[model samples]
Target: MPVFNNKDITLHYATFGDKDKPALLFSNSLGTSYQMWQPQIDVLQNAYFIICYDTRGHGQSSAPKGPYSIEQLGQDVIDLLEHLDINKAFFCGISMGGMTGQWLAINHPERFHHLMLCNTAAKIGNEAAWLERAQLVRAQGLKPIADTAASRWFTPSFIENNPAVIKQLSDTLAAGSPEGYASCCEALAKADTREQLKNIEVAITVLAGEQDPITTVSDGQYMVDRIANARLATIDASHISNIEQTQVFNQLIQQYLV
Candidate 1:
């Protein structure tokens, strides 16, 4: 676990594959860390410079109390890229990370050659809803709200077949810093990339899970319709579809990259 200082925050990062090849940076969801992309890392690293890191307050990264905006989160990516001297690369993000990708592509379109957006939306949900949820979590704790969140993130059938996977991912939510998680939840509530989505002219792959309850296929469809050259694919899992359906998720992403 190597750490990079971006002045404001230190990012905990790890890499795999050839450094000479074009890079692929993985930005994770609100409750997740870099490890969420484990399924893709092993397969894609050989061909691409694969980098994954915990965001400002998630995983092993330093947690700075923030009422952070989407642009600020996007700047975190920019800061890290400059730190590593990475001028251009492919950008991939999931959920909260996907929101950051929207920011990256909009703010630094020239820096990204392609985009991979998984289980995310331009506007996740209304501000009132997320703020309410944040307040509830802050007052009641994550475990009390975990079951409801799990249901929204995974399918009922998935919940039946893979209890252990659900439990593991849910546990990650439990370990999350309340302040960090709540702030991100608030970010999602206020996030609106509709105008920015229209501005994205680069090739983008909007991948979603057919069974995803959080960011629905409908959300991905909106992205596909908005971005000029965006293509859409539907996997057979939930919000954390890549980990939930590794082989299928990896294959779809691999095909997109090729």
Candidate 2:
């Protein structure tokens, strides 16, 4: 329930484990909240101080206006770190969060020990598509997106077997703020770090979903090829690998953080 204000925005964040432990920051994807990281937290809390926060337009965070930038999303993390008085941490982010991690690594390399980009790409879908999606959400609300999210987020088998999980995530997206979601869609529309990938000095581990149709394994490979000190790991889940392949994802986290 802890919250912090960064200028005009208020971000909701939660912490686990001991402050004395190494800090591990978790940033959620476009439509999800900090709670999306629960599976990882349940396993890793004893070893690290985990920090999970909702992005500006997601979760309990304040949704300001429209057309947010990747820089704004990245700066929010820096502000959160400053608010918590943490100088350095291991960062993990998925999809849009991964995009934010790229911006952070390129712009604020001094603030992180390592970064894990999961089920994401340096440049996601085209600008026109993102803009169109933003417009669609703004016009029709989140139901349209939420209705089709499962197919993008999980494989058919996982969705069919995990009905409750799918419902929770879908419902969360459906209930999310329309302006906030659209604003972030606008941010993603302009977020392209392909040219800037080579500039990232901080160590990075890109986790790709083998079954992910949104951000493919090739996207993860592209990042690893450009980054100075980066590697790639592939998981057998779709876009939301952490939820679909929890044990394997948790294992990878522990492996990299060590």
Candidate 3:
């Protein structure tokens, strides 16, 4: 267990590449852990100092109760970077991770060299809905959501063609702690980055999935329009755009990183 103390929590993380190179940090979506970004790690490891970690509670990390704010999550990332003594990095996050990236840009501008946010929104769902999700997940395990999870995470074709991958992902969730999953959902439901987005003056690239049912393209466009130097790139995949279309997504990210 590669763990680092973040004061409030101990984070279970996976680190790759080397310290001398530019760093790339990836954040996964809700109900998912850093393992969700393993594919990206495989691709980016050679060129960047890659950091991927399970948020407190979800994967191999310790789980706490009740609620956690997005700012706290962003701060955790900063703490991790400080733990490693990384001055700057290339940050990319999907969905909840994207929100974290936005928060980081607002409060910890010096931590990143470049930013890429995919399948994310400035304001996630309202608080009531998020709290409800947390409550339900606490009552039931992740299995109940497995079949329907794809509706929000991946398109039909991707799910149908990649049964093995989907099964593995579903299994990952099925085994996840209900408390941890629900707590993150609560964090998302109450998270609204709209007011704070103006504070993010860093250059950013927003990647939206055209077929994404969760955070639609409009959400991505909104971020692009709001953030001063932010640009939007729309892909044909669903919420997990990078997974569905890695070739195009990876190439675009590489171009943006350059």
What tens-digit string does per-residue lDDT give for candidate 3 at 152-213?
78888888899887888788888888888887887787788788777788889999999987
Name the regions of candidate 3 deviating beyond 4 angstroms: none
Q: How does model 3 score by TM-score?
A: 0.96
TM-score of candidate 2 relative to the true fold: 0.99
Residue lDDT tens for model 2, 53-126: 99999999999997899999999999999999999999999999999999999999999999999999999999
Report the lDDT tens digits of candidate 1 across residue range 23-79.
889999888788888889988888889989998778888877766678778998988
Q: Which candidate ranks first by TM-score, i.e. highest? A: 2
Predicted candidate 1, C-alpha RMSD: 1.5
lDDT of each: 0.84, 0.96, 0.84
RMSD of each: 1.5, 0.6, 1.2
lDDT of 1: 0.84
Model 2 misplaced stretches (Cα beyond 4 Å): none
Error of 2 at 46 (Å): 0.3
Look at candidate 3 and give me any clashing residue pairs.
none
